[model samples]
Target: MNRRLILDVDTGTDDAIAIMMAGLSPDLDLIACTTVWGNHDVDTTTENTLRVLDHIDHSDVPVYRGLGKPYAPIPFLFPDYADSDRTIVHPHDFPIASRTSDVRATPAVEWLVETLRAATERVTLVPVAPLTNIAAAITLDPRIVDAVDEVVLMGGAHALGNVTPAAEANIWHDPVAADVVFQAGFERLVLVPLDATHEAIVSLDQTRALRATGTPAAVAAAAIIEQRITGYNEILPTGAADTAPVHDALCIAYLLDPAVLDVAPYRVQIDTVSPLSFGKTIVDVDNRARSAANCHVALGADATLFNDLMFRTLSEGR
Candidate 1:
């Protein structure tokens, strides 16, 4: 039996790769892919999602646009660059359009609420971006907490942060929304943070191998990586100069094969106050701050097996 899954993405470079992985998986019946605002604007992310699906000949997957901003009003900053006026950080950069596409008539949060309410089987929600839409849906209908089977997301960081000295980009973008979702206390919430994603690095050689797959998704995946990769050069871990971490793809890989990740329970809190650490995810590992474990934080992964799955997923529908 195929598990029903829904992808909530911001459609960044890794998000696009993860989209292909989810759309092509034989073990999963991808019901829908909802877009959010994180890597770029919701419009651009939604467009990129459709392009990826269409390029892979899976355009039938209904793409919907989610929240455009965080719950509380704040200065909207583009990922990797701050903008007080909320202008386009990079006009010609990624999330560039490959082909034109239209979004669904319904809002993402509305669809989310209705879908969960109507589903006979518990749905597996994979959120690889900020938790704005998920938060909204939960706020609209709290019953989704029980309706959702698992939330395997790619956000937060255990020891190190990507956006700032104390926050990962996804959780950092909308800590208020992240806080809402985390505090709701889903029974099976697995957070695949940067700590685990960094371990699953895809190097230049592996990217070359993926590009050689000759599939449209694979070719576009290679191009997107090459185009948006330079910005991450300074953040690449030691001995990974020619490699990039497939952050969101690792989360989907975990869903397909649990053996790819190593997780431990942790009590987490999101910092909503404090301008310096607005979107910081405070993880309690040693029981110093919190009493019970609310979320399962992934600390490590089997990079070898993850890369194999990524390549295999990208190699399909040729």
Candidate 2:
């Protein structure tokens, strides 16, 4: 059975890989791709999305431009814009990521709301960026909660976080909107947090394997990953040796093969107001907190099997 998917992305390097994975896969029907602001600005995100879509001949999938910021405005007032506010610094120019021409319409929030409301089959919502657009849709029509079948997102972390000490980049980017989805009482919610994703690493070997395939998808993925790795190494001290943990792709992988991951349900909450802990997803494993478990969280991933699946996707699965 082919599942209908509405993928929400931020057009980061990992997101580019995710777009290819979902768009190329025959098992999933990517109805539309809604771009958000996280890895880059709304405009950059949209452009990168179109570029990736162009790579796999999925330019037909409607690309809707989304919000510039979170549904709730930023709380802290920085008199000056910080570097963090700007686009994610990529190592390579990503000439492929820079396609300003052929941009489509805007106000993705409307399309998101209308599509969910009108869909006959329940659509699988895969949000790989900040949950701004998802929160926006819920605000316009809270009833869209019931319309969604499941939400598989890539955000948060189990213990260690990549963004702040307590939060992952996606969750930290916009914690308020994340709070809405966590408490919206959706029937099914699954998150592929940093905990599980860090295990499914894309090392040099995988890069070579992908490149060796010589397919357009494999070549494109290798190019992006290799360039990103180079960039990370040059910018950060620990970048060179760091494995490319294509975080966003984990969510899509989980949707296709649940066996590749170890998912467990737990009561989760978002810290929306703490300066130190904002955007952190707190899971109550002891059930000490209030509210029943509203979502399933991944604690572990079968890295070997996951690598195999990813390789298969590039080689033939897609």
Full-model lDDT, candidate 1: 0.81
State the weakest 10-residue window (summed lDDT) of model 2.
78-87
Worst 10 residues of 1 by lDDT: 82-91
Q: Could you tell me the lDDT of residue 113 within candidate 1?
A: 96
> Residues 1-318, candidate 1, lDDT per residue (tens digit)?
888899999986888888888888888888999999987789888887888787777878899899899876654343453332112222235543565556899999999999999888999999999999999999999988888889999999878876777788889888888999998869799999988988887777777888898877777777766543444554344366766677898988998899999998989888888777767778888899758999998899888999898888878733
Show where candidate 1 strays beyond 4 Å.
Answer: 75-97, 234-238
Error of 2 at 144 (Å): 0.9
lDDT (0 to 1) per candidate: 0.81, 0.79
lDDT of 2 by residue, 224-284 (tens): 7776556445443233374557778887788779897899989999888776677678988
Off by over 4 Å in 2: 77-92, 95-101, 231-242
